[model samples]
Target: MSPSLKAATAVGVLLLATACGSSNGSGSDASGLNPPDLKAQEKLGKTEGEVNLIAWAGYVEDGANNPDVDWVSDFEKETGCQVNTKTAASSDEMVSLMKTGQYDAVSASGDASLRLIASGDAAPVNTDLTPNYADVFEGLKNKDWNTVNDVAYGVPHGRGANLLMYNTEKVKPAPTSWSAVFDKGSEYKGKVTAYDSPIYIADAALYLMATQPDLGIKNPYALDRKQFDASVALLKEQNANIGEYWSDYLKEISAFKSGDSVVGTTWQVIVNAAKAEKAPVEAVLPEEGATGWSDTWMLSAKAEHPNCAYKWMDWIISPEVNAQVAEYFGEAPSNARSCELTADKDHCATYHASDEAYWKNVHYWTTPISQCIDGRTDTQCVPYAEWVQAWTGIKG
Candidate 1:
């Protein structure tokens, strides 16, 4: 199975098991709750000798998977901070793990970053402490996903879109819009797949933003009760057409190769892998735009190895290292300098790493809250916890 697939399955199982749980944990509470009062580091300190991290499967490679692919070793050797990593499969799991205070830092996606900030699990980053942060794409820095109240919470890592992948041999006429797997999804019933997680609700909401503009969904993540319900209704309708909801890349690859799944959502890495295996597949960012992720490397509020954690953040985003990881993980490097270091001359162009215009319509995942992230003050928006429950019901 692919790393992304593993992440999806892990997320799917966890979301199902914790579906009934309250979103009120930490950041999901009623409006007016403030993030924990934690200050960013003011100065660099002595190395703490070690750092523990919770990251997505492919983010922290130390050569265990492949001898040729190892970035953690150099980080450990350079900083003298022994690197111990825990792979988190889902955003909720990252949030849950951070709450324990056992780890020093995490590579949080937009969906989990806010919850960590609101719950006080993550600390505001002192960008000054990590000089490499200055080289990150201006488009990624201090955005709504990693910054709150004008404070930076983490260092931007990388980003990618959830593209529309279809079997060229099976899906005809070529799809340019998300409707291929949405309201018109029934046209390819029993052969469609989708990412299996509550975060996927935002994809439905994104579609509604274009197809049903009256819903007034200025932000897919900030859906009000009505908009949220409509998004959920769309998912429920889509469930019948889904041959399998995938979080595992291997399964989706197999499904497409075996002719069980012809069209649905996917990552660029998954498409690359499938095509390399001789699967007749192609992926594109549809006309309605798409949902994507920009991961942040956040320091834990209660981190034991602050100096070492800060060191890792800087090293990971450095041009050479960032290029290596971004290429390995198949996402655009957040650092602009990394583009020149990539082995594939076209890597940046292929992923639109520096294309600011291309990302204008791609909504990054963010935790939904009652206060409304989209700037509406008239109504309370649905929180992520409710999204979890609704996702469970829709799948049922």
Candidate 2:
């Protein structure tokens, strides 16, 4: 989708969230906790045998490339702790599955981590416990989402933005402003698409940076009452232009296939899957900047295999594992050493691992709250709390 169109639609339709509060991989609502006691879990290190993990689709795979790629196997071998995993399609699912208190760790996106922290479903990560913590880049370290009131909940993993991917054949000059999708000029009206998540409200915030600079929105996830109201108004206007707001990865691919969408907000994985199918597509990091999420490995507040979780964090962030995962996933690696280890070190370069400028403007996902966009500081802005309620009302 064009940046403007995506931004405009993002403002309108992104906040449709429905979370299932189930525990484990099972569909049962096991345990309920209002606020997770991370301290209690911190003290329960490596006491349990089987570790349950809730994560995204590709974050944990079927162990295709390496037998050891399945983190569960490697953890068992090293710490004698068994591993169990349940895949979640969205952050809402992660929250629901974690409610049962069956999973020891969860891979939460910025949008979900705050809810997890608030509910006391997840625990603060003890950096000292994981040896690999030292290798983590400061750039990705300690954000408003994972850290609340100075305590961190998880270790940083992989990161990327919700960039625009398009078929070069359709548009000659690349799209810089979010207007490509928002303006909905006669050219690509019904053919456009966007993400159907509430968290995407930030994309709208991003576009407003250029169109409505008077609001002074630095972070899309962060907003105050007046600013938030402006953003919602902008979104309501963009909603009229949207054809289909996408949630599933495959659905986005199919939209591109039918030529129903010429441009839209997409991830590296979606682009990779399309390329694998020989689809005509191209991804661009728009000039007005972008909004994205970084997946983190956080220990559960009720974790039984703390040692195993720590080990897995260290092992995965290692140069070798980072390179393998990045190459296979088609996203940039957070580890600097991964570039040196990869046979085709150029992949890291192409992904812009070394460029400080590119990432300087990229806003990592963070849930907006009453206090701040990331809920880290007290400085005021439109909090996501209001956005959620407004979005909830809209969906209802």
Candidate 3:
């Protein structure tokens, strides 16, 4: 089966499971591109040491030791540092692990990075120590999650948008509005799917900001009382159309394959898997734009293997390694130079790695704190706390 078909089948299975219960767990406009220089930074130290890393389940894979894979052996062979990895299913799990000071690095998504930084469990990264830091796309450097007060904290890895993927056969003309999932009228009753996690509650808020002007929502992740109520009200309507909420990649794919769902919110990874599985799934970038998350490689503050951690970070972003990481992770690589190394030029085009036009409008995800959007401070919106409460109420 093609990866797409496999993904659709997986999503179908996930939908079935969700029918049983609730699941847990960029911008751009290159005008903002002022990436830091790494050439003047200190050179990397010695290798041949060990480093423990915590990351999402599928991130570090080697195709051996578990059939699914483990990526550390290759690093061990090259740097002589035995890589120890602990897989986590959610951001919460990653935070608790970091507090123990047992690991050296973490592959954290936007949702978890702030908690790591706020707790002082993760340290500000010394970009100088990682020679390959210069290769990161200028647009991704020093954002709200990884940098504070201009000091660097992590290396850009790869990124992708959360797309609306659907079966073209069932949904005609393709969906352009976020309302396709949010609206619960007769048109989409019991056919829509939503992301099952609490974090996705922000998506409903984003839709409200674009469609409803009176709420004056500056940031979807940051919500004031009225905006919060408005978003929760919208989600209550959305829940009526939603057939089920999904959490697993394969499960999401399965939903599309079986035609159990005609349309839903999804990731490029899930879409890629579905296409590889031969499912007739198409991913759409909506007209009003979309929200997305970017994951970064952050080093733990109390890392036991700091030198080895730096070495791995440097190696991961090198053109060759960046290409491999992007392809394996099924997303666009953040290294501008890696475009030349990609095996399929069309893949780069499809993924928007080389499209400056697309990046100009895409709003990269950030944790909603009092600061508001990464660069916008003209007005203060609500904080993540309000959004979290609204989300909880909506779920209830």
Candidate 4:
């Protein structure tokens, strides 16, 4: 799936195994999060005969998408839990399907995670029950998007960082920070490009978090009016130099290849695609960091097959399985151990799979809401709808 264009998904009714319990293991405490009063599955029980799942189109392929890309078949054979999959094409559909409460688990993106949590459609995951949780990258564990009230809501699946990609020969003095595209963007004039989603506002917010500390912007996703305005203002200024806004990799690849976009934000996949086409392009996680994308496996709060759901969660994140999913999906594996098992020995290195230090500052994209995701309670933050309106005006 092209995470950039990901929006909503479809549904499938699923039966679940029963299990219950409270969990004490929450990865990190976000400042202002307060999760719903739901408990995670405590222990494994007898597997239900069947398990229903909702996922991104390519995420749960049982060889129907392709013959060689079957992860579910092995899982079914080993666990004895029949796997039924419904692929979602958008986050809106994913949320709607999850809310139906007919499914056991879902592979949700960051944009839909909080909605699931707040709506109580998702349950906190007992990391202790999922042994594979131990190998998950520290960068993906506990944070504003998937964690709340000191409780981990799900298992991180995969990730991709938005990077600063520029044409090698055209842009002199290689940039190490985002300032190359913001403060100094005039140097490139109308040749600059950026993602076109309202979420891209977080990119400008992230740059300000480093360069304009006075704005008190801690989390790029948690912007109060002042911080939001500052971020929007920055984007408005940057708009002066923006040649075009892009929402897909091909548009960006073509722009970079034609020298129409010399420097801007991009994903590793796009850079690789450009390089293969012989484009002189290089991408980096700038010193100030970047906004990226990720997916998490979360259980249904009303899961009928809780045991099977929990087992599926653990199974999907296992090192071998994680490696397969990561490689097949073209994203960095969340399981640090998965790096060692990839068929392409350099896959981990190429995707920075285990590079905690490199990913330290990368902020995965999260949906912005009124409740401060940063944990602030004193002020109301800008919601996503406002962000969309503001983004339109900035681009206009």
On residues 90-189, what C-alpha lDDT tens digit does candidate 1 reach at each position? 7878889999999999998877888888989999999999999999998787677777777889999998888999989888889999999997799899
TM-score of 2: 0.81
lDDT by residue (1-396, candidate 2, tens digit) is 422222222223222122211100111111111345447234325435666778665455436434433544555676666667776766767777878877778877776777778777777777777666677666666665556555667877766667888766785577776677766423676666777766666777778866788976655665766667776766666665566778765667777866777788887667766665567888888878777766678777766666666666666677777676666555677677778876555766666665657766677776565555332354665545566666654333
Better of 1 and 3 by lDDT: 1
Candidate 3 ranges with C-alpha deviation above 4 Å = 1-44, 65-71, 370-389
- Estimated TM-score for each candidate: 0.92, 0.81, 0.84, 0.86
Of candidate 4, the 10-residue stretch with the lowest lDDT total is 15-24
Off by over 4 Å in 4: 1-27
On TM-score, the leading prediction is 1
Candidate 3's clash total is 42
Flag the better candidate by TM-score, 1 or 4. 1
Please give, for residues 246-356, the per-residue lDDT of candidate 3 as tens digits: 776676777788887878888776787777767788988777566666677888888778888888787777777677567655677878888888666655676788675
Clash count of each predicted structure: 3, 27, 42, 15
Least accurate 10 contiguous residues by lDDT in model 2: 20-29
Candidate models: Cα lDDT each: 0.82, 0.63, 0.66, 0.77
lDDT of 4 by residue, 232-332 (tens): 99999999999998765466778898999999987776777678767899988888877777788999998888888888999899999898787766679
